[model samples]
Target: MHIHPLITDSESLKSLCDRLAQSDFVAVDTEFMRENSYWPELCLIQIGNREEAAAVDPKADGIDLTPLLDLMVDNEDVLKVFHAGGQDIEIVYNLTGKTPHPLFDTQIAAMALGLGEQVGYSNLVESLVGKTLDKGARFTDWARRPLDKRQIDYAIGDVTHLATLFPKMLERLRRTGRGDWLDEEMERLADPSNYENEADLAWKRVRISSRKADVLGRLKALAAWRENEAKAKNLPRGRIMKDETLADVASHPPAGQEGLARVRGLSPAWGGNDIGGRLMAALAAAKPLPADEMPGREERGPGLGKEGALVADLLKLLLKIRAREGNVAARLIAKSEELEMLAAGRREGLSILTGWRFDEFGRDALDLVEGRLAFAVKGGKLMMTRTEHSQ
Candidate 1:
């Protein structure tokens, strides 16, 4: 693979734009950081037209991104493709105040193609293209000057490889008659609201394994507080409080500074600071509920304890059979949540029964559960065989 550097200047950007305008499509990727800040720290932008793949230095002095942004808006005929595009699009929105026109997301396409949800880039490349990308520079700070040659190669490989991989995947998409499916998925990425962080619903991301009603209420308040704090300070969520810590606070519902001190992961400074005082006040103001009226904890037992462990194993085997048979990623076909719901005899929205996923992988899954399907150990490989009553 060859790497090309596009000088981050108006003249060069215009030249790059000229090349892209004549192309049918371009594969693009970005490298950025967001560990310490609320906004993505976009450091590098890589672009690949039909002929050459180039890396743009966004950190270079006096480098304006306007020309590139203009091309992104003007190239309506050319497809702008990326892998795992949401965060990358967020960076574009932040930098250009315009989303790229005619966008395609490989990750979304992968899911539509049955590659699975949140599939890593390396995994997709290895699985589909049969090549292993060098990941040595995975965590390098892109903002630093004098970027190492290997880093530049790694950065350029991102988009350059996609130039080849896109059409291969696209052909597969067309042959399977799922070409329009990708178009529908792209429409979701085009939505600006999906990229914007919804502050009101931010609490939904937190994980609360189990907690009392009052504790849950306090946790909600804490989430709201953290959300506001992170936004105001332009810092990461963990800089305020880590998710694990938040869950601990919710579970314990610390009433005082003393109580807050006892919770593990509670920052000592945070416990005694103004924020800590506010947390205490929120807890006090929250109406405590009677224990009996409080929300009951979810039941937990050994895998075999709740239902037969063998049943869960059968469901998993059935899921794999359905996934392979349909040539779709098993997770996207039916998540563990969906599987558990199905295994528990609750059969709402079983993709195997409802939509395209059902037609592709879901029906077989449900049949497997109904004992109309069986597995056999043949040639040292388990094979799913249809029983007469499977249908």
Candidate 2:
């Protein structure tokens, strides 16, 4: 439970490698800052073998990570267990210039094993290990010197949980015959190409809930500007402009320097900054949309009143019922997007038709859609009732 610091000198890294070579799996986690730059600011990495968990201060001078990176890249038998591995893996690739091999992501595995998608580390650890981690220090600037005891303790907890959680998740995955599916997801996580950020496609990530075209243009401008600034300044996006404020600017489309002043969520200093003018210009330069391309972002998710809305709702209820019945996460059964798509006439991508999920919950989902089953409410609780000839 105590935080252990590992020596990062060449010899010590070699010693760590020797220990890892003997183990079948090692738990890993990273503490990084991404507020300033295009790449994640990797500050510290916590790695745990079966015997002890160690935190390596990567920012320390002359601390060579080649030995550790070599083991991560070359070792096939040692499973690198991580929770929410995406950003950690991205940092590893950024630092080592290589991707780790034969990785296992517990978050994704949890979903495949009937946990939820994008499950947080604390929640997963509580569910799997019955331990509540101290998270008060989670947002502290890890890149700062004279690291506090609390930050170090928080860092160590990340890797330590992996040792036990990995096996339990793996066992459930095996029992459910979803080991391959989990493997596919882990491979995707470990692959360096999967983490690449294509700035041009960044606009797709902007949420559309309360936006207008002018605002959309402003956001697009802000995003592009942020991408360039982060690359140029080597600072995180927030250091330039917070996304929430950018969303606001996009909606209001500042009329001018005065208009920019009126938009909320921006710092008072932001109006005086040079970037403010650039933001205004970006909004102004946006090509007025043709009618075809102007469809609002609301057109994105499952439409409630559409033909499939009732059926989709029924399927979602069934999914929840099945999740409760199976003691698995309801999100694992099917996502809202997939259910919406299925209800809207795109039936092919349904998990029910795929691998293990199909057997667990997809079949019932399709059955409801095909009129083989129906939904009703009893005493304020919704339930699925089979109407077809057979279950």
* Model number with the top lDDT: 1
TM-score of each: 0.77, 0.78
lDDT of 2 at 339: 81
| Candidate 1 segments whose C-alpha is farther than 4 A from its true place | 1-4, 18-22, 66-76, 93-102, 107-136, 178-195, 254-263, 278-312, 369-391
| Model 2 ranges with Cα > 4 A deviation | 1-5, 34-39, 73-76, 96-99, 111-141, 148-154, 191-194, 209-219, 244-273, 280-299, 302-307, 375-391
Error of 2 at 173 (Å): 3.4
Cα lDDT of model 1 by residue, 184-270, tens digit: 468778777776666545555777765556766666667777788788898998987888888777667765776776677776775
User: Scored by CA lDDT, what does every candidate get?
Assistant: 0.74, 0.74
lDDT of 1: 0.74
lDDT (Cα, 0-100) at 258 in candidate 1 = 65
Best by TM-score: 2
